[model samples]
Target: MVETGTGTLPTYTETLPRIPESARTARRLVDLALTVWDMNEVRDAAEMVVSELLANAVHHARCESVRLTVTRLSDSRVQVSVVDRSRAHPRRRAAGSMEESGRGLGIVNALAHGRWGVDSLAWGKRVWADLEVTSGE
Candidate 1:
């Protein structure tokens, strides 16, 4: 993991293969970062957000691997991001009742409270979600 930040805010980053199993590792990274920062209040949400982000990359991106970054934005907020070599941005689509897929972004949207978006990079794109830690965390 690479740790970098300005003063108190810390960011943790890891590069993982673009495979389904990588989502588990991504979630673990999220859990560890939030736990160490004493931001357990948002750990679960962060984990889910990371999982969905990584899943999107694994299923859609043609890259061999993806970079996951969990950054502490503030005392009560954290941002989870996945960078992949796919320029195709994500789109929100309505899923049928029997559909098993197409709900990942929706889940991320709800978990992040609509605080998620994609950043287009020169080589690819970055999908990120911001989770706000509740009070008393």
Candidate 2:
């Protein structure tokens, strides 16, 4: 496979607040992956992370609305980025007694094979990270 950096091209987008509606956007990321990742495992990983991040934003970030984007990068890596009109960063809490939530980023960090972080953007803030993917085509 040839390694080419084509900047950042979003594969999908969604609103975190509206989980179901936002899910439709996540499907587009799968379509983008078809051209790169032919395997279901690799593509699903990216899509799942995209959903988790966006959902997290809606659950945590106090934003009117959130935007989710996924971009394919070089070195067989794909970035799942979420932007929200929020100042609070992504946080992980220790799982307490029958806690129903938490562990989103941790799951993402564990599944992904690269770096992830939260940063301040011009408008609000963007939580983005890279997931190293395998290509067999």
Candidate 3:
């Protein structure tokens, strides 16, 4: 079972298969949540953040499925998280220009403005990033 963060704020979540195609579903989830919250300004960054997080879980986690969550942390911020049955924490690595991979976390970090981290669960881990909607949005 997934906790919806005390049920205080609006949230969207779905359990997705551990496949590449699920990333698209996760992105749509984020888009939907942000749209409903009237936070479209951060929709693009939130979508990209969720995509990277979901891609990492799909490619690296040894599980049948994963849980994706999008929670409104505040009026100006939202949290995107991916939970998988893998305890191994994600690592950020340097990728060369010619490399086609190893840049997922880098993109998450940039888009989230360093407001991202992983939480260890008894069954797995939750990787999350916070996207803030700037003023005048």
CA lDDT scores, all candidates in order = 0.92, 0.66, 0.90
TM-score of 2: 0.73
Per-residue C-alpha lDDT of model 2 across residues 1-137, encoded as one tens digit per residue? 12233554535454545444665566565446545544344566667777677777767666567776666665477677789877777786676668887877777777675478888977678888777755542
Candidate 1 residue lDDT tens string, 1-137: 77888675799999999999999999998898988899999988888889889999999999899999999998899999999999999998899999988999999999988999999999999999999977654
TM-score of candidate 3 to 2 decimals: 0.93
Tens digits of per-residue lDDT for model 3, 16-85: 9999999888888888888888999999898889889988998889999999999998999999999999
Q: List the residue pairs that clash in candidate 3.
A: none
**Which has the greatest TM-score?**
1
lDDT of 1 at 9: 70
TM, every model? 0.95, 0.73, 0.93
On TM-score, who's better, 1 or 3? 1
